[model samples]
Target: MGCRQSKQKSKDSLAGAKKTGSIGNGGAAEAEFSVISAASKTCEKLGVSSKQIFGLRQSWKGIKRNMEDTGVEMFLRLFKSNSELKNMFHEFKDLTSEDDLRANEALENHATLVMTTLDDAITHIDNYDYVSEVLRKTGASHVRFEGFKSDNFLNIRDPFLEAVKITLGDRYTDNMESIYKVAITFILQTMVEGMEDALKNKAT
Candidate 1:
């Protein structure tokens, strides 16, 4: 009787497992379909084809560097207009005066973390839900981590976007609404290419 009960329980457990697996797969399929549908809608809105979006191969590292440089450039621009802000920046810079090497090391470490976080986020595009959740969480967490309010994420994005506009000049801003659409195209292309390469290597 004990053995029979154990066998029956095993069979039930297996059935439950199968059902859970099926549900998980269905959910993933739905998510994938939603992503594709959203991409299509975006392309239509931008008056561009999907092929245009997914055709370019871009370097993730280069994008992150471009973004960071843009931020630094914007900071400098803002500093020029605000003496108080310039003083604050100088004060921050002065803290490292005692040991130039140590200051350099600290700057390098911070840069590494920033780039790593951005790259990891980008590389996980195959899991869109996860990527979205992480971005939201990261944005919120940055406030506490950086000793700023949670709303700074939204505030900060505008400045960076503006910096991009300034840096790219008229070429990037010609089609105002489609700027983001074209940016997403490059991002998705890079992500898909990376994922494909990863899968091919794994299969080999």
Candidate 2:
């Protein structure tokens, strides 16, 4: 008798599961819907719509083709405006010339790493949980570097946009520029949050 009751309960559970799965689909069992993203919500608040997301991914394809050069350009722009930041990187900090900076293996590798992180963030733009965790970890990792401050992430803002503008050349328009601004701001903000999280965890 107990065995029969157990079998009946299992059947009921399967039936209930089927019913719950069909709740919002007009009684059709097709589970077609949108994936929710915390990151998307934050982006929306920052004026990045689905349309802009599509544009970012599209434009990024061009950037990815020349990742190394673009990454180097970004860092070059950064070093240009904030010359003092170069001291943080011992590998190429002593080099004052643009040609030397571009030729340095260390700077190239660092630029590649930064660009790769940006690529990941853009790739997973809709997935808030993933992007935030990645960015936060990135910030946390900087804790070990001497003179590294969370605000340093903010410094990427202008240089990054300029780098993109240079890379895109004729493709870069006023509207696209606006979208890129929103995208980078969102990326840097999360990174700062991650840095702060890391600092707190370290203290504890």
Candidate 3:
């Protein structure tokens, strides 16, 4: 019964996705559909649809446009949940204390930047190559950080998801989760791949 219900929910979300969006059309939609269709097929190994990623992107845009300080809240949750990890960040390293978020302009700005980057990428989610390239650069940039690992990204991704859940309130759906899981997984994988490539290049 639960399985059936989940499938039905997916069906509803995909159906609603078509109606909920007014942003893409003509060649844009076709292009996105092509890219998403291929990615979704690849994601079948992971049990998610590309359409779900599209729905996730749409739902996020809705929440973000209407919410205030969500990104800020997200970073707070991130730091709170992963206190040890926070120390790795330059902004939080000199905190004088583990809990000193006050007057942390860099933390605030960096958090906002991360959230805004996500927003920008979701807007062009179909631009997979471009998105992957940018994320790769982001991962490559982290090479200089001591003890940083690809898995550490979950410390960032999970809190961001929680913040989105909170902001969406009752509007959040399982469908979005399904889609977001795929998108997030793919993103982290690409970033890690980039990091690995950077390490290899530097070693050579």
Question: What TM-score does each of the candidates earn?
Answer: 0.41, 0.80, 0.68
The superposed Cα distance between candidate 2 and the true structure at residue 31, in angstroms, equals 6.7
lDDT order, best first, reads 2, 3, 1
Off by over 4 Å in 1: 1-65, 77-128, 143-147, 176-178, 181-204
lDDT of 3 by residue, 1-204 (tens): 111123433444455656767335464445445454544444354464555655665688765674446676677777777777777777566575434664577876776777766776565454566677888888888898999886776566777677777888777777776666666667767778888899899999
Score each candidate by Cα lDDT.
Answer: 0.43, 0.78, 0.65
Tens-digit per-residue lDDT, 109-166, candidate 1: 5434544554565443333445545555454343323233333223233443455566
lDDT, residue 169, model 2:
95
Clashing pairs in 1: none
- C-alpha lDDT (0 to 100) for residue 20 of candidate 1: 78
lDDT of 3 at 40: 47
Candidate 2 Cα deviation (angstroms), residue 97:
1.1
Ranked by TM-score, top first: 2, 3, 1
